[model samples]
Target: MPSTQRKKIVFTGGGSAGHVSVNLALIPSMQERGFETYYIGSHSGIEAGLIAGLPNVPYTGISTGKLRRYLDMENLKDPFRIIKGVAEAHRAIRTLKPDIVFSKGGFVSVPVVLAASLNRVPVIIHESDITPGLANRIALPFARKVCVTFPEAARHVKNGKAVHVGAIVRDELFSGSAARGRAFCGLSAGKPIMVCMGGSLGSAKLNRVIRNNLEKLLPHFQIVHLCGKGQTDPGLDKKGYAQFEYITEQLPDVLAAADLVVSRAGSNSIFEFLALNKPMLLIPLSKAASRGDQLLNAESFRSAGYADVLLEEDITDIRFVHAVQQLYHNRGEIKARMKSHDNQASLRTVLELIMQTVR
Candidate 1:
């Protein structure tokens, strides 16, 4: 049986929104269930900013390093930073003395997981991608159970720790009002709305393509471009287009107002879009920049008839425009398939499983 006393759960994830998104979904729910939630992340990553928006969730910033795939001069320096972070995290874990730690697989999570293991606290890690990231791979052996959004990821987890919990989208995402969304963006009901977001840092490739081809798209749909921090164009303004640096409280409404979506195929966002039955034109992050996880994520959805993939290398103005047109034309069919597929298992399972660990 779960404990009757109020428990505490420390969540650690950062670097990008994908890493922190699951933590965001779980924190409020955990708090409501009488678990005090605290966050540990890098001082400057996107996580700090996102967590700041949520009241009552105390955040602790630690010294951490970015885990890079390739050799770089900074690689030598990062090792020391990681060591310092681990020491700091261990001290923090000892001070807080939480019952359990939940990690969402970012570089900042490494030290926190190590600290949790050192403190003999059970750990839960959520992997959103099919392949385990370097951070998650490092922490997996120490974790009690690893929850995954993708079933195929189970094979990659050793020691029988993987639990296929599906995707845990926030409950508030379903409560957004389209009228409020339209009002927030200054877009009206005369034309259909197409929302484009390229993950937390925004996509330069996506922003450029959409902006350059707006003339072709504007006649058909109003565009709400979430063009990351400092990515918006002040010089060029269009009648039916709106720009935001990055949205927090307004995201649900914006998503509610979208008739179609053009986005990067990070597992968390795509799954949320899937749950919302939003047909996506996915432009996965290219292999050169990432470990090709997004590429795999996009292909899996495409094969399942949930979304259409547009590879970064193959993107031209003509191809980009056609993909959006094709997605809109086939939106009804895609929505029907999405509605039929149950994207509803993760939140409850993960919540129950994590609490069970502490119990």
Candidate 2:
């Protein structure tokens, strides 16, 4: 911790919002402790866009290849790209000389984690699903520790390095005002408000279903639909329904005003909803679109009594409406169960582990 040689950390995660959010949560804490922070991610990936504007965190983009389950023409060329990425990442890490590297589990993280291992830097990777994704599966052997959001995920790590630390909920999410949120949405207190999120990239299937049922839903609840980028519908602009492409600074306010949530079953989003004690109807991504991680993430929350799940294939206008109604009816029970869990403790444990790894 000497001024001449400050502690340094490099965060590596990308491909989706879920991967980058955990790193974002930890950066401020790292900065406050006087550690020099850097981020390594894909040049054109979502991580690049997210980390580009953060002050004091230098972002270094490296070549990354997608790790896919299915066969693709790109698959033939990506392994070479991954090799190049590892070489580039190794060069960056060697120059940065970071004390530790933390990965939040994405295809972009594999090369970075491998490079960290090669450089003799300790690496910690967090898996947010019940089973580790393909990237994390590859990176696990190189990781000094594997942190998991679910206890079941820990058992599958095989390396015996897994820690069940729950989800890392960002601190800023709790600072929202209901009045401010209502005002921002121009909503009245007369009706309950429902917030629908289709993850950061948005869900086309979920978007269509929600819009199709808006008339049925609007009478019972005011709606704040974060319809993803370029998914907004101008024709559906009606009273008590607000559509946003995305929310950044005003996200907390939006969450604060929501009486219930309808969202995709991404671990970070569901965990954030749980932390806020909001009852949710989750529609997870199908196996065709993903590795079925969201399906497992949604099931885990449902089993824990924190949420209600509606599979993508099983969704219909009537079923979706019924699930929302059921969630509203049982919201008190859901909130009570959520209150029994502790998110702050999980954040503290992960932060302590990160700091401990560096030392």
Candidate 3:
């Protein structure tokens, strides 16, 4: 029989689905093994509603904000916010007394990670980007195990503890059938499909550029476009374009059916594309993204030959068409590469490592 002492695991981080999905992926496995789980995120971030009402889990929120590039009058108020977040996080940690805290890095993770460390709770920090984010960098030395999605990220973390676990993806990505996926979206099996999703919120630039070239895109391929609520211009409400605010439950189905995926270089989207063995055209947002990790992630995927990378500033109608055509025509190579590149054991390996560290 197992010991009476409970095994508690706390996962922290949220803003984008990219940061939070890994925790969601890990939950089932940990629960099956008899571990109690808790989640910590920000009240203001995108994860609030998603975490709410989930079973066998307690979700808590801390006040957090991004560290902006240009100093503003608002910057003066941020120190107090950070202090408040740290205090709230410390209180949460003291209450939970988790066996270990697994953090997916972001500004939201920083204060919680710091609080966990101060309270002497074992911390596991996972960096899902090709390059680690600022919060990850700040908290790296404190983590007992620093798990990375890419080998390139290892150099930045001062710890010899950093281990590359690839990316933790839901099993649905690997199990969905392409035929059913096509039928569900009303896309033709005979025609190739192109999927463009900008994480959960979607990408405005991808939406705009693709909208500008929709006529050129539609003739050759069926389109499943997720134009984030912010990105859906009225211009895109037309035929042959399956537009969406988000496709939470049906995402894997749409992805599996697509021959090629056009997306931002966010780690979650990139890894999911790789897992599904779908060829991809990666359009990375410019240096505008808080940490500029997407730029590096896009370049890494491009260099690996699984996808093509296009810079936001450099993208144009002709170049976009040419890149899409190039990928479409030679997709066999990309598909072959994706089949050969396997990293599906990341979640189990990471969870086991975390449990071992706590033991």
Candidate 4:
């Protein structure tokens, strides 16, 4: 018989919203199965704030250093920080004695994965992008199984470790009502709604371009712009457009009301849009700002007939409006493609894998 005792699971991921969202999706199911969940992450990172608010999951903050690809003075100090982080994580894991550690592939997760491996705890790492991030590549050796959203990613990982389980989407997302969303945003049913998401930290370039072309856009569509933290424009309070710094509890409603989406190509966000059947125009982060994972993610979506891609560096007001128009015209086809695929099965598969690993 399966053990009657409540098993413990440790989750480690952060740095970006994409890294943390998959962990959130699995938490409710874990709690229901009588698993005591704990999260280990950076002291003041976005994950700390996000995980701290969860009811039963106790979050432990450890010293973590960013794994940078470029030359920087901080890179020298970061190695020592990582060493300290590993020691701290090792101590935490030793005390917690979790049955397993689940990582969502962020810099903060590297130390935690290493610590878990050292303690002989099974670790599962999930990669959201088509390609593994540097952090995941570093922690791959320590992971017992590597779960991936894309089949292409499995090719990059060691043989037998990678599992293509699709993407984990929050259950609450399916419960959103378009009417309720419209009401929350104070929009009428007259115009199609376009939800513009720049991600948790926001995208200044996307925000600027959208605002600059609002005059042309508002006539055809109502806009709900999730402009990121501290990026809301105070002066541009115009009709047919609403701007929010960020949305948490009401995100589903906002998404439910959206007819089209203009957003960054984070794997988690795009997969959510796909599951929701929202046709999107993806403006990925430039290679200058990121490792071009978003660019790759956007391209994959475009190639798969899921979304329209617009390179950030090449965007102009005219081109931006034209792309949104193109996405709108092709919305029906995109929605058809999205409906043909159900990626939510990944949630159950991942949960089962975790259970199997624990047993």
Could you tell me the TM-score of candidate 1? 0.97
Per-residue lDDT tens digits for candidate 4, residues 129-180, read 9789999999999888999998888888986999999989999898998898
TM-score between candidate 4 and the true structure: 0.96
Report how far residue 171 has shifted in candidate 2, in Å: 0.4
TM-score list, all predictions: 0.97, 0.95, 0.93, 0.96
Candidate 1 structure quality by residue, lDDT tens digits, 39-86? 999988999998998877899999998899999999999989999999
Sort all candidates by TM-score, best to worst. 1, 4, 2, 3
Candidate 3 lDDT score at position 281: 89
Clashes of each: 0, 0, 0, 0
Q: Relative to the true structure, how large is the alpha-carbon lDDT of every model?
A: 0.93, 0.91, 0.84, 0.92
Per-residue lDDT tens digits for candidate 3, residues 226-328, read 8876666665566667777777667777877888998998898798889888899888878866468888898888888889887888899999988999989
Off by over 4 Å in 2: 1-4
User: Pairs clashing in candidate 3?
Assistant: none
**lDDT score at residue 20, model 1, on the 0-100 scale:** 92
Candidate 2 per-residue lDDT over residues 142-195, each given as its tens digit = 988999998888788986899989999888899999899999999998899999
Ranking by lDDT: 1, 4, 2, 3
